[model samples]
Target: MSRITTVFDKLRQQNRKALIPFITAGDPEPALMVPLMHELVKAGADILELGVPFSDPMADGPTIQRSSERALKYGVGLKDVLSMVEEFRKDDTGTPVVLMGYANPVEAMGYETFAARAKASGIDGVLTVDYPPEESEEWVEHLNRQQIDAIFLLSPTTPQARVEQVAKMAQGYVYYVSLKGVTGAANLDLRDVADKLIRLRSRIPIPIGVGFGIRDSMAAKAVAELADAVVVGSRIIEEIENSAKENILTNVYRLVRSLRSAIDEAGSKH
Candidate 1:
């Protein structure tokens, strides 16, 4: 099995749900990234999503967009993000690291080169928000050849046929958007979201992870009861944004640990 598959299998065996925390690689500062990553793992993050800063992040909310902008100002490019991951993997081989970003930079880097560089840098998987399943066959084949999982996102609005196609193509967990809008939105309905995820679970073989509108421990715990994993982005970014550079690591550790325990408790109740 792939590294991602193995990780999910272990979580399943323990009756636990994965807690994925997202961070822009160079947000706040690039020098602080490795320390932040270590703190996240120390606080019980099952998987880490290292976001690459893009010029136009269409899927991200205001918080992540500002974080990406901060990263860009620091000259955090794709190569820099890979270097951060390379440094992170020197000590952390157990935790799966997935790069989440847009396709514009990947295309600019050339598909084959991007795939090779990502694998060589010890990245386990990638989630390109704008890459549709039908249009991703070639890139998916390239990444698969390099032993890297090509993860995909499925929204509540995704049609049944496309959901099945994405499930068949997705190598890692399927990212199920909890709502039909951008990240950090309000008024999320757990019952309606659970029903949508149940429909997806009936069709997909891979683990399903819920994101978007999951801002606090309570929301994360609720989502964990139904999905295999819970992903938090904007809230973490908000923490980083609100804190000074010296305190960013400490804040992230505390926040991630709280969410981790919350999800674990939710899973236990199930």
Candidate 2:
């Protein structure tokens, strides 16, 4: 099985929800990327969603956009992010790493070449924001050949027809954007999310992870009760954005650790 499938299976057996944390691969600086990844694992992240810096990240809000800007200021690209993953694999081999970014970089590198390098870097999954399920058959084929999971996103606006298509093509897990707006937007209604998930679950056989407006432990705990996984990005980026250079890793570790504890608490109730 792929590493992502294995991890999700293991979590299912343990009656635990997976905690997937996201951070731009080269944010702050390229040198600090691997260390931040290790710190997240140490703080109880089940999977790492590493963002590839791009010039125009339409789906991301200001917090994550700023993060991309910082990483890009240092000229970090797709190859650099993959290299960071390669370096990270030198010490840790089991944790699944998913590349989350726009499709431009992947297209620029070519799907075949990108899949090969991603597999070489020990990447377990890819979440290209703009690759709709209808247009991703070839993309999914390449990743399938490389044994990499092709993750997809489903928002509140996603139609049932598209949900069925994603169910057929998406591996790993389906990311359900908890709200309608961009990454850092506010006003998440748990009732709305719960209702949407009930409908999605009937069509999607894979696990569903909810993200976008989850910004605190209370929110994470509430989400953990309703989804198979909890994905926190903007909140973590906010933590990174507010921390000092020397304390970035420490602060992020503390924040993620709190999220872990909260998620575990919710899991125990389950």
Q: lDDT values of the candidates?
A: 0.90, 0.93
RMSD in angstroms between candidate 2 and the native structure over all alpha carbons:
1.1
What global local distance difference test value does model 1 have? 0.90
Displacement of residue 88 (Cα, Å) in model 2 is 0.3
Clashing pairs in 1: none
- Pairs of colliding residues, candidate 2: none
Over 4 Å off, model 2: 267-270
Q: Write the per-residue lDDT of candidate 2 for residues 140-180, one digit (tens) a residue.
A: 99999999999999999988887898898889999999998
Q: For every model shown, what is its TM-score relative to the native structure?
A: 0.98, 0.98
lDDT (Cα, tens digit) per residue for candidate 1, span 143-171: 99899999999988898988988888988
Sliding window of 10 residues with minimal summed lDDT for model 2: 261-270
